[model samples]
Structures are given as structure tokens and as C-alpha cells.
Target: MIVLPRAMMPIIVACWLYYLLGVVVVGQYEWQTRDAFDEIRMRMDKVNDDNCQIQHLGDLYLPEDAVSHLPDIKDININPVFPNRTALLHLHNMALSRSFFWSYILQSRFIRPAINDTYDPGMMYYFLSTVADVSSNPYINASAIYFSSNMSYSPSYRGFFNKTFPRFAPRTFRADDFNDPIHLERISTRNTFTVQDLGAFPTTRLSDDYTTDFYRINEWYKKWLPDNVDKRHDTKTTYQIEIRYANNTNETFTFHGPPGADEYPGPVKWTRPYFDCGRSNRWIVAAVSPVADIYPRHTGFRHIEYPTYTAVSVMEMDFDRIDINQCPKGKGNSGPNRFANSARCKTDTTEVYI
Candidate 1:
């Protein structure tokens, strides 16, 4: 090897340092992204459910084609309804109540990271709003309790590499700050909308008001964004609708693309149940997050996208239907194979995790 000049040695060393910086920066970014998902699910799991209302619905299951099978499933224009003010407050606060790492922001030329645990209201809103916007299922938020768990993961010690990062998020996402997710608990009385003989379909975050009811929502969203955050705007969203049926089975559906014009016939997504003035069914609607390009593929963590989302949207809805069946404690989700103790069937609860 040729001997390098003394002056060149400093440049070589500088190059080496730059290389190490990328390794550390990239590694930190990847882990922070991975960990965000991990904490959310962990929080959701730790919380005790108030009780799944769906359990009461007799052991009914929606077939895969439940939506497509409907007599008029194709003729619907699914004008989504949104949550009420009380519910909105709860959702908005839960999202802004805590601090978190804005990993997506890391990629943004805009935001500059701060210290661990530094609160950034905007990122929280992004996380909360993204899930809510896609669909209004509470489980999506519930399972992501980690998003707000005010904990930090970046190593305390740093070399020159540390400088490469703007600043570690001051606060890690925490659930305690907000009530975790509103849906995980029983529907609040204020939000309850009963259907005569059937159970209730309390207003979820996905209610149309989220979009139309933009004023109050903005009060929270309008908060000072993390530095360099872009102004908020809407994007075309694709939501995968999941329903927990009466037979203790799951029915899944999604929008391959926008619905057709006119008759809106053929290959439509999500069953559009006619809302008779009386006597209707109850179900849970959980939302999954739209895909975020900032994250990597096969993120070991679950619930990153729909089975595979094309773009990031505001919310992800997962519905849990609770008809009046409380299937006799004998029916098994997989048949007699189901047990009361197993809490698994006529309870065949499957989730399309976001």
C-alpha cells in the first residue's frame, strides 16, 4: 500500500467518521421505526378490555363474500359517519397527550430531532389521525398504545455519529398520557346510537364528522407542529373493512379502487347495510394505518399496512359486530372444537392488524 501524506490522513479519518455516522444514523432510524410499532401493540395487549360487545352477538360469522353477497351491496354510496364531540375530544387528547419520536419526520428535511422525551404534538396527531382517518376501529389505536408510551430508545452515549441525528425525540410514545385507545373500552354512553332491538353502534373515530367536523379537530391538529412539518392535507385512502360476525367468524373486505359511478355496481368493497329506521345490527369497526413509505418492508412488527396498502391515509377501520346472540356457550368458532374457557370461538375473532 502506498503511504499517504499526513494532510491526507485527516481527510481519510474524516471519511471514516462520515461512514460510521451513516451506520449509526440509519441503524437508529430503523430501530426507532421498528420500536414504534412494537410499543403500540404492547400497550394494546396490556390493557384489559371493558368486554367485547361482539361476544354478546349470537355465534354468527360473516362469510368472506358477505359484502359482495349482499343483495344491494353494490348500490351503496357508503357515506361514512364520524364520532361525536365527546368521542372526538377523547381521541384528540389521546393522540396529543403524549410525546413520541417522529420517525417519518426524521426522513423529512423539515423536522429536527430534539432530546429524549421532548413532546411533539404534531407527530402524535399524525399517528392518531392516520389510524382514525383510515378506519374508525378502536383496536387499531388500542393495539398501538406504544405509539404514545413516553419512552426513549436511542442510546445515551454518542460519538461523532450522535451529532448526525438532529435530536432524539424528547419523549417516546406513551399510553398512560392518553387513555390508550377509546375503542378498547366499552362504548361511552354519550356516543351510543342504538338500533331498536339490536345492540348499539357507538360513534367511532371514523365517523364522517372526522372529516366534516374539522373545526374542533383542528384545534388539536393545529397545534405547533414539530419543526419542519408540512401543512396537513388529505390523500386518497384505501381502507380494509373487517367485521366480527355472529357465528363467531370474521368477514374481511377492502376497496381495490374507488367505487363505480351511477349504479355503483359490481366488485364493490365493504357491505353497505341499509339503516332501517328500526332494528339493525351492531358491530365493531377498527381502522388500520395506511402504508408509510418511511418504514422498511417485512418490519418484523405486525400491523404496518392493510395486508399491503398503497399510500398513507388518515384512518384504518376494523369493525366488530355485536348482534344479540351470545351464542350458547357450546358452539365452537371452529365448531364443537370451540370452548367456553378457550374464549376463542363462536368466538373466532380474527383481526386485520394495521
Candidate 2:
């Protein structure tokens, strides 16, 4: 049996009591923390389950037993961040308007004859100038605006002359037969002509000026190209001539056949995006339409004649210029837009709706 002093005994008891109180408090705190964490986990699981249910409902079919059903929800919530709609609208309108212009030219009496190689240079110049004056839309500063017509002649006629009466050939000086038998014989003897037999001959003639700049394009090409070195092609004189406004001036340009040249037989054709290294020196797209007769001719028989194509007109525009100021300024993909701003709305140029 050991006895302690009264003062020491009290101090030792006090120390033991302090230790017990600390253990109880710390255990209580730890238990509370664990309980709070479990509660948070349970809430998160409920939220996940609710989200799954909502997604599953989206894939379910409507109830057949319902008396009346609401119409489908078609209200699209397009935010202002979208700009593709705006850009697409602009492109579509531009293409549509250009189609109308080319269609009008092909339908005109003078222009159709011009394509067939019957018009005089003076008349062609006048026609080209008139078209250029109205070709530019007031809203866009087009990098280049041009029109091209090709004169394709084969001595064999490729069944074209066979379709017409024999009397129609010698009696009438058709577009293909400009100066009668002499011209026909001359063209038949050779594969190609160094000079243009027609007024708008692409190898030589321009809108108001003529040049030998594109003389290399005069040779026979299996395909249409200005500088086609591979001359081992069939016999066909397909040359394209242009009346153009580019480099702040009126001039004539020529091309054998670029990417979209042959597609004019169908509806208005738009070329894929391309880089114009020779002339425009920028990314561009071309719209081409063929010069075709609008009215059918009476063949004196029961059969009706359909429209025939002569030449193709082309319009080149800057790709960036077409898009203009339609895109949004933010970081994420701008989804769509409802309205497109035209030249009339934002530019000082003339107002023409697409």
C-alpha cells in the first residue's frame, strides 16, 4: 500500500481526467465527419439515378392509350453564338442571283446568237460592257466578274448537222457555218485554227480588246487547258472566250476548261473551293451556266425541238468575301443563325436581295 501527498494526489487525478475528456471529444468529431460524408454519397447516387431515368424516357415510345397527345416539340433553341446559318444563307442567295443573270443572258436573242458565233465584235463588246455594268452586286466588291462563251466546231459535226435537214444546211448560214462552204471546208481541213473564226473566239478576242496572251490555248486539247502540253487528243476546237472586269479594269480572259467548265450542261454548277494562282491570287469559287436556247423550234414535223447549249458563262468570286462578316467572335463553335446580313443591310453598295 503506497500513500501519496494530498497536493500531488489532486494534480495526478486532474491529469487523468483531462486525458479521458480529449479521447471522448476526438471520437465524437470523427464520427460526425464520417456521417456527413455518407449522407453526401447517398445524395449523389439519387441524382445519378434521376438523370438515368430522364435519358431512358427520351428513348421510349409514346403511350398508345392516351386520349390526346401534344404535338412534337419543334421549337429549336438556337443560341446567338451560331453563325453558320447566316453564312450559308449568304452563299445560297449569291448563287441563286447569279443563276438568274446567266439564265437571262442565254435566253436573250442577241446573246444566244453571240454564243453561236454570229455576232460582230462591236455588238459583242457592247453586250459584254452592258453585262459587266450590272453583274456586280451592290453589296459585294467582287474580286473578278467575268462571262465566257465557247465555240466548239468539229468538221464531222458529231451528229449535230445530221439532226437538221439537208436543205437547212446549204440554204441557211447557221452559226456553225459562218461563211458557208468555204469556212466549213477550211475548218474541216485542219484540226485547229491559229486565229478565231468567230467574233468572241477565246484564243484572241476580249470584251473590248483582243490579245495573243492566251494564244497557247488555241491548240487541240483532249481537255481544255490554256497551257496543255499534251496535244495528243482528238479533233475538236473547243475554245472559251471571256469578257471580264478584274484588276479594276475591263479586259478579256480565256481558259480551256477549268474544274467546273464541263458541268454547265446541268443546272447552275458551283465549283469546289480552289486557289486561283494565275489571276485572282486568292481562294475562290466559280459559278458556271451554259448558254441555251429558251424556246423550242418547230421542225415542220410532229416532233418538237428541245433547247440546245452553245457556250458557258462563268462568274468567279472571292471565298472570304462571300462569307463576309457573318461569323461570331467567341471561342466555341457558333452553331447557327436565322438571318443573313446582305450588302443592303451593311454595305454602301446597291441593294439587291438574293
TM-score against native, each model: 0.21, 0.28
What value of lDDT does candidate 2 attain over all alpha carbons?
0.32
Q: Which portions of model 1 show Cα errors greater than 4 Å?
A: 1-61, 68-107, 110-123, 126-282, 285-289, 295-354
lDDT of 1 by residue, 99-139 (tens): 11223322231133434423323434534443332234332
Compared with the true structure, model 2 gives a TM-score of 0.28
lDDT of model number 1:
0.27
> What is the number of backbone collisions in each predicted candidate, taken in the order shown?
67, 3
Question: lDDT per residue, candidate 2, 1-354, as tens digits?
Answer: 999988898899999999999898787643333332243234334433224223232121111111011111121133342243333333334443443443334333233323333322232342443244224342221211222222222222322322321111000000222445667554532121121122333333442221122322111110122222233432222234455456765534322222232332323444443443322234444443333332222223323433333334344445444432322323442222211121123334687899
For all the candidates, what are their Cα RMSDs to the real structure? 29.2, 26.8
316, model 2: CA deviation in Å? 2.7
Indicate the residue-level lDDT of 236 in model 2: 22
